[model samples]
Target chain A: MRGDLPAPSAAQIDIVEVGPRDGLQNESRVWPTEDKISLIGEAIAYGAKRIEVASFVNPRRVPQMADAEAVVAGCANAPGVTRIGLALNLRGAERALATGIEQVGAVAVASDAFGIRNQGQDRAESVGIAAGIVEMARRSGRSAQVTIAVAFGCPFEGAVDRALVIDIARALAAAQPVEIALADTIGIAGPGEVAALVAEVRTAVAPLPVRVHFHDTRNTANANIWAAVQAGASVADASLGGLGGCPFAAQAPGTAAGNIATEDMIYMLHRSGIGTGIDESRLYRAGRWLDRKLKGSSRSKVLVALPPGS
Target chain B: MRGDLPAPSAAQIDIVEVGPRDGLQNESRVWPTEDKISLIGEAIAYGAKRIEVASFVNPRRVPQMADAEAVVAGCANAPGVTRIGLALNLRGAERALATGIEQVGAVAVASDAFGIRNQGQDRAESVGIAAGIVEMARRSGRSAQVTIAVAFGCPFEGAVDRALVIDIARALAAAQPVEIALADTIGIAGPGEVAALVAEVRTAVAPLPVRVHFHDTRNTANANIWAAVQAGASVADASLGGLGGCPFAAQAPGTAAGNIATEDMIYMLHRSGIGTGIDESRLYRAGRWLDRKLKGSSRSKVLVALPPGS
Candidate 1:
């Protein structure tokens, strides 16, 4: 029975805090550069070893990340933490490398419809661009990772093909990125599908780590994250206060389609005897801080439901 | 290897719609008797075969359920549906049988602190009363099932012991109730804990179906529900629009700590190829109707994020 499956063998799973970048990028209100830096500092203080500090997208398209260089430079003093910058193409990759960010996150889309709308590229073109970005980062002596977005389902194209995702993983693996990630960009995946896909992707990118990213549009993000971890995913991405939504992804008019909350993820993981090396109490405080800064209640249940001291 | 576990062998899982009873009981705003009957009728039309139409508790304590008898009488003519009534003791069980409801749902608490606060009885006394209610229902030629509440964790006592839950399950199984249920009354269980406990409880009550209930207080309810189903639970309880929370369970002020939404559960189950026999589209309509009647938005993500026709 699945219940009897051995507990996750890894003593600790790496959590990639994406609050500063992905979490803030989707909000209509653009946060100041100082607040972004403070968010990263708080995350580091809460024991987040890997964090996505900013994305190197076009300023006009993603004005929320317009101060990426300033944000990246502000956090350069932090020691013993891997700062990541998300990039969709070689131009963004060059910009990220220019900032001396520790890691470059290259994104590839699994569907042509989403790819065209999201980054003005087709599926094949997106994969090639992501691979080129990885190669550029490697030449610059920085680590790079590839994330296949809409790997599970696409809002515009509907069901994404698993074979297409596998093919993308294999092609990206040749570039020898640090890991391959499968992203439920639309939050349309169930646990079974996540387990099967993560397992297949892990096999496809042998020896390379598997990371998982999920949106909570359908309220299955935590379950999908747990399923991915159980299927051998070693790293997962979450945002503080569950503050994120893809600006391009279709959603209800006023609903905040956020990612799985970082605090909630840590709570589930730590309570299950799984090590995340992240402090739950501190994350709760950080969530509250972010909520206050945004003048909005946190989308994370733990932050709202449980006191930080608890 | 866990991913390879065969899909749920059961072709169909029973979903006991608890919106009318558990859903409305927690809300401060009392829904009229006609609205309660309309909710039940809509649920039946949405293909829910079993429903908890009302509860026979103290009208003064749970004024939202003050019209229990009227709701029961209004729904009595519905055929092919097992109408369930919740009761905490023998007197309530007698009232349930007197109303000609199909099943009596007796609730037992696993923790003394929560048990006493929730139903004016401690752990041992609550189990004894639950067993007595089951016996009373059996004597009246009616079906009865016992639900062990706070089996995962308690608000006042914190972590509940697995041994205690198993003992209660064994005690309830001896009464030969139709099934045994474990409820996360305060929504504090992780997937790992849920899987292990459900497996143990299923073993203790061999051949008697295991039903699972959860509140999304901490955003782990869907994950926990999926884990329970994977661990061999044959039945689940959900509310329309995710419209239920324990009146006695501690929660964040102003936050709706509702149960897993019936539409969300159906979406996950049916998408994974497990049959729920419930129509997701109709559930969306029902959710919207409930939202309008209550003058509040649904707690269900699927209803808010996806269009009804989608």
Candidate 2:
């Protein structure tokens, strides 16, 4: 250790690998259902405990992930893995609950335009659905997490008021859900904003754990992860090969860019002496393999810059 | 601005534009030298007062910068643009100083193997060259700005101790340079580390304004930039199109993946209401056009996501 360098924090950082859900959802060349299962299995094998396995959405809309059932079933028996699913609507929630997945995710955007474009609903309607979904998850004896998308700034509405996000977060927290995640859906957050928002949410949620979901869309996810953690965010979300942008979320209407690369995030955390429990070598390989399959080169600098193994 | 938002800082954030030097250096296709001048013209027009125009390294070493002298000469007459040059050795510094550039950047690396592979010298030898270059710059009545590359972590040496980086920064600061930039040459810094190191360096060099140079290699550059600013980094180095990593700087060489995109940085800052004086529209245009010309694509989320004339 360097003289007077920062000592490692006593906090145990939890990295919720969103590659299976976020990464796969954004991939143009969809992997077969079995391959998706294998990917999640691989991640769990590499020390990822909490993984977003699949999203329960309209099959016609996202043809790539029509087999949400299979992905969930594939990971149900995986050792020490918490399989999660995304439920955008009541039908999605009902379907996800039917799978008996312990954790389900309900999502909404902070901006009206983004919420409309992303979920075909207004902010109030999305909140209503979040409340209903929380109730459903509870009735089913499962826990659901609410992720507020575009919590930082929105492309359509510009800068979103942090108060709006916090207000909605308070509402969702009142529902007493298991977790809440603040997302930079379009990658518009700065480190200061990340710190401030996480701190605010931590206070609002009190003892309830808060999470951060970031995109490398502007290539700042890793730093934001740290900022959120510093502000007491318990967990962070990342996509493999930095994948997972809402096809409807306009980063560039025609561009193919998305979330923060898992390998890059893992590298920063591991090198900083934070306990992420991830193997950098395996993570890099997964990113490379995923990108190659999609005919998209990874945008993660660490994954691309390092050799096959760190 | 939200009512809950805190009053913005009056900090005079400085942007050290490297499009002319770092951006043009690793371009895949030739830029006819004059094209670079046009680019520089656009940046200065967009209020970039501190522009690094060219490098005085051997033409054979970096063929893209073969016309360093002509490029500097052309940009030298631009109003309010402080043209600088990247100098590798005393010869480069002598040549750069002869051209009337205000600042000559001398680089040293923290890691031994990277220092040798990157600039053909070890840390001590590079320090010696840096000292000599500083002497030459001071003798010519110009300012010397030394950049310690691979300060965060080097590709060859792996994990770089913060102490080595601090020692190099202290030694360079002792030489009375106008500024010292800490380069995360391989882009592996976390937000916590970025903030901690910047805070530490602020103490290491009491009054000198510290700067940071980051690579978006792992999509953490923006986060690191935010952390740097919050931790007291006054200036940041950026390039358009997310271009400019030395072929030897990383384990996965020749990826052309380094530096946070200037447009991305400005977008994040502007969203946070920090004034960079850079027109986001112009920055995006330059990034897109540069990518088109180089047969390369930008890794900037803002550049890729935002509309033209935005």
Candidate 3:
């Protein structure tokens, strides 16, 4: 069996499935709420303990997330699974809390240029807004994960400063959210940069768990992820079938606008001897099902390369 | 630009282009001799100091490489470039040397099953043949590099033992070839396995100048390469446009029958602050040319993702 690898490192990492929210938000095809819920269930079956099911954003701006409440309602109460909902502001946080999900996710862009372009706020203003959401989640006895978008690079402002990212992460660290995620919003980070930033953030935030969100735009995300894990960041975000990327940043031809594929990550993590309770076979099936639902081929190399059942 | 990154480690690594030999050998479409020679020239212009141009295998078995001498005659004698010709045995090595190429490459499979299947010899017998080839190259004042095929996994015989790979490396170390390469022929290796094996092999054969050859079969090639480099392997093999895989192992579905793309590896290496001497724009153009010649898309993510002049 291909799964029979040399004993891997003893680190067990958690992959938070973000396809339903981050993936669907950018897809050209808006899957129905029912199909969206079904996809989340499939991810859960593939050993996704924490899943971001929907984003509680304005329906007018993001029509794909129009049925966020309904999607959450369908997936929130799964036994032992931590259902997450993304909230862009305090109102979005309230909406997420209303669904009774335990975790609320929000974004804080690192670059001022990307902050205004993506969220109509400057870096400080965006961090302030995210702080409000994180505070609201805490008051409601819910955990919050504030992801610093463009932490590695920006589309509008190229070459985001490492010090700027670290400063913003430090400021967010004061909010004491359950986790702080550094996102390679444009997928321009290599493993060296990732390791440097993760080490800095891990030291800055200390006990606050550091998570990473990577887009495989340049095909360096897997190596970047390995580097991050080696640098003490335990959590990462992945999409089924390697689906989803920031729509604005994905306009370039053949840009991999997707997060790393769940099955592909599972394979790497498992073979590295890092425990990720995921079932590889089930994850492969999820990728296949996602491909059919999207009416296109998946970007996942493993899903395409390996035949079913090894 | 996507090129600005933290000061990369002060390590300059060598990327040996294998597209012409390992890549074209397995390609279903046999590129014309002129096109093959042109590709080698393009790789040279893209800053490939070491290029593997052809293999002296039986023309009947690998008809694509039948014009090895012609191909070398065109690429050899290029200023500051080392042309390599792969030979499976002394006869092959002699043929390679006759082409006036300074380097003769050979293979020594780690698994007995793959050894028998690929070279019609068992592991010990194949190592003996490779030793003889090395001896011939040494007497002729030609450099030889013996790549241990299926160093990580084998298609016919799965899960090659680590001890067996180390044992093979130890045996070959006595021959004192110019370089020893560990090839993940089936691309089933992960970063942990790669680190472990490279560490063991580096210790087993100090100062042998360890090199790595990876196929992106499981989407873990980049990570594996990263791990290998971290563990002190300074040389890696890549194919232009991510071309080539072992034809024998590529029959399976979704098998990555190609080595990592040269342009993609250059991108990662350069961004990591590891200088590869490869001009990214020139490499991209080469990939574009390769795609056109092959009448298919280039498998390089960086080549396809970014637009011109980015």
lDDT of 3 by residue, A1-310 (tens): 3344455433788889988888888787788989998999898888898998999988988898999999988775778888889987788888889987888888998888877867677999999999888888888898888999988777776788888888888888888788889998777788988988998898988888899998877778899999899888989899998878532345552233868888788888888889878888888888888988867567777876765554
Over A61-138, each residue of candidate 1 has an lDDT whose tens digit, in order, gives 999999999999999757889999999988999999999799999999999988998899999999999999999999
Better of 1 and 3 by DockQ: 3
Clashing pairs in 2: A251-B305, A252-B305, A301-B217, A305-B252, B215-B259
Give me the candidate number with maximum DockQ: 3
User: Which wins on lDDT, candidate 1 or candidate 2?
Assistant: 1
Which is the winner by DockQ between candidate 1 and candidate 2? Answer: 2
Sort every candidate by lDDT, greatest first: 1, 3, 2
Task: Write down the worst ten-residue block by lDDT for model 3 chain B.
Answer: B247-256
- Can you give the lDDT of residue B158 in candidate 3? 76
Using lDDT as the measure, the top candidate is 1
TM value for model 2: 0.91
Off by over 4 Å in 2: A2-4, A8-10, A245-257, B2-4, B7-10, B28-30, B246-249, B252-257
After superposing candidate 1 on the true structure, give the runs of residues whose Cα lies further than 4 Å from its correct spot: A1-6, A9-11, A246-249, A252-256, A308-310, B1-11, B246-249, B252-256, B308-310
Model 2 RMSD, rounded to 1 decimal: 3.1
DockQ of each: 0.46, 0.47, 0.50
TM-scores of the first chain across all predictions?
0.94, 0.91, 0.93
List candidate 3 stretches off by more than 4 Å.
A1-10, A245-256, A308-310, B1-10, B245-256
